[model samples]
Target: MQQLLDHVAALKGEFDREVFTDSYWAIRDEYDLGAADEQFWPPVFQRAGIESDPTLVASAAAKDAELASTIAREPHQLLLEIADAGVPLGILSNAPHRMAQSVRESDWASVFAHLVFSSEHGLMKPDRAIYDLAASHFSDVEPSTIHFFDDRERNIVGAHAAGWHGHLWRSVDQARFELRSLGILTKR
Candidate 1:
């Protein structure tokens, strides 16, 4: 999230620092999770009463580049364990498009039956619409059978309220333990 803010600041482009900060945050304060960054940046500049640089529009590549470079992605062993146990997996995330595209291109893409990103659907997590949208992807399965794991408590709150089996993610071991309790993990 800091990376996203930094990108916006950089694109503010020679404007007054205070004004840029105010403008950036003003839009963020009322940010519509249903809109993509590509759609969000322009309005921020417009509201600040400045013209956006023609070359400074946000894009999927820009959103992804910093995260891909700085974050170390460890092995998703729990997902692998679940896959080995023949559980149908799905991923639901509130992020930009490139992140989702990267996951789809990953070697383990086959482990998940579906991957839903807010950037593609235009609705983010904690919003009933996105959760319902994800649920629709597994219409054949009962809600009682689905499990969702995320690090954020707020998102888990939303998931729980929506009738998803939500787990606050910590480590793979803890997640496996929880899944074991629910009979979703056996061998691992």
Candidate 2:
């Protein structure tokens, strides 16, 4: 788990260091910058390679749109299994409200008892306020009884600080094992 966390941390560092260079800003300017919204920036920055040109940004946006559509939905077997055991399930995600609503529109939302999105609360993960909000949902359950699963290490750390058991999510199998170890999920 420590090694997995280290790898994720390293990837985050690399992305932060390389993805938002001066060339990205230049490309943003070429796109008539302010005209394009925040949603366009990530793919533009990733694809443009810092040259800051309209063609690159356009190309990047097209590629990103294709990639987004191509994303395969993973089976929520573990989530369903956990929920079937009658354990209360909650989601605390940093995703935008639209994304959260989309998740609910999909089959995944049925698996959770509560879904807390950062954008709706004006707070994001790793911020104690968001965790506190999530914690509030499980009022009947002790803080230690509430287990949190997130892909981000910082969020997991925050969960721990907020007195909840935290699992650094990687695969569903790993997550299941962690939940079982914490006595939150029963073995089939």
Candidate 3:
């Protein structure tokens, strides 16, 4: 990611990692709340003592999308089996608009019944609003009947607070076991 940051810095002039990092952290929440590339990048560039060139902004957006696309590996085989078994699957992600776009364009997008991104909703995981919104996607399913798995403890805690079953994800085997214990997945 530093390499990408370096490339972004080179687009205008000398790069200061400290300035860039500070600038990015300052508006990280805004970016995750679905700010457009044009909206978010200019401030970072300006903060880094560089001109907010349109070309530079576009390049940064492209790099962000590219990086987000490669962040997740192929979907787990268990997820595929779950989907194949007629169970609904949904994605609730705290990601920027560019990341959302990349995921929507990926082949795995079809596997999910719903995809919710913080950028689109102005809320992020570990927040009750986001959990409530995600629960709504299930329509007829009651919150207690819903199950969620996340590697982040806070996110799982949020899920539980929202009245859904939450699992602290560790590995595929762990997730599979949890699902089976809940009777959500039974195949051996």
Candidate 4:
């Protein structure tokens, strides 16, 4: 995200890092950036004073997009490890609907019971409604028992406030350590 923002910032003089960050989240909070996949971006770019198609602008930054899409092997292995131990898994991402498409294309689709994204519901994280919606996918599970891992402190705080066991993501080793503590990764 930072890389993509920097790419656009280089093209548009007015929207520096701070301006881009503010506008991006403000728009995501207002309309959910994934509401129309990449289409939700044109309005945002317009706010930043760039009228060219956001997709075209994004296409010009192919390298950043490519880097963004790469998934590490360790996370995949961790998912398989826990899944094989019968721990149900889910994903709550404040990303575009294209992320769901990527998950579908990869092995992650089967590992997770569901992928709840912001664009689909017109709500992003820090919004309790999105957390409630994610919880709904697991009918019998209590929200307090569902652990959410995110890199952002605000998102972790939001998920925790929403009654989930949200934790800041650091490393795969840390995750395995925590999951083991929860007894969710015990060997079968």
Clashing pairs in model 2, backbone N/Cα/C closer than 3 A = 23-50, 27-52
Predictions ranked by TM-score, top down? 3, 4, 1, 2
Pick by lDDT: 1 or 4, better one? 4
- In model 1, which regions exceed 4 Å deviation? 1-60, 63-75
Pairs of residues at least 3 apart in sequence or in different chains that clash in candidate 3:
none
- List TM-scores for all candidates, in order: 0.68, 0.64, 0.79, 0.74
- Predictions: Cα RMSD each: 4.5, 8.7, 2.9, 3.9
lDDT of 4 by residue, 19-113 (tens): 55666667664344455535556665666666666555456334333544467899888989988997788878776655555555665558888
lDDT of 1 by residue, 1-188 (tens): 45654665565544444565576556642333444555656766676555765466544245643464232334356667888898888888875555566667766667789888777877887887888889889989877677899998988988887888889989877887898988878852
Ranking by lDDT: 3, 4, 1, 2
Instruction: Give all candidates' CA lDDT scores.
Output: 0.69, 0.62, 0.83, 0.72
Alpha-carbon deviation at 39 in model 3, angstroms: 2.6
Model 3 worst lDDT run, 10 consecutive residues: 67-76
- Alpha carbon lDDT at 173, candidate 1: 72
Worst 10 residues of 1 by lDDT: 65-74
Candidate 4 lDDT trough over 10 residues, lowest sum:
60-69
Candidate 4's displacement at residue 91, Å, is 0.8
Model 1 residue 160 CA deviation (Å) reads 1.3
List where candidate 3 sits over 4 angstroms from the true fold: 6-14, 48-51, 71-76, 170-177, 180-183, 186-188
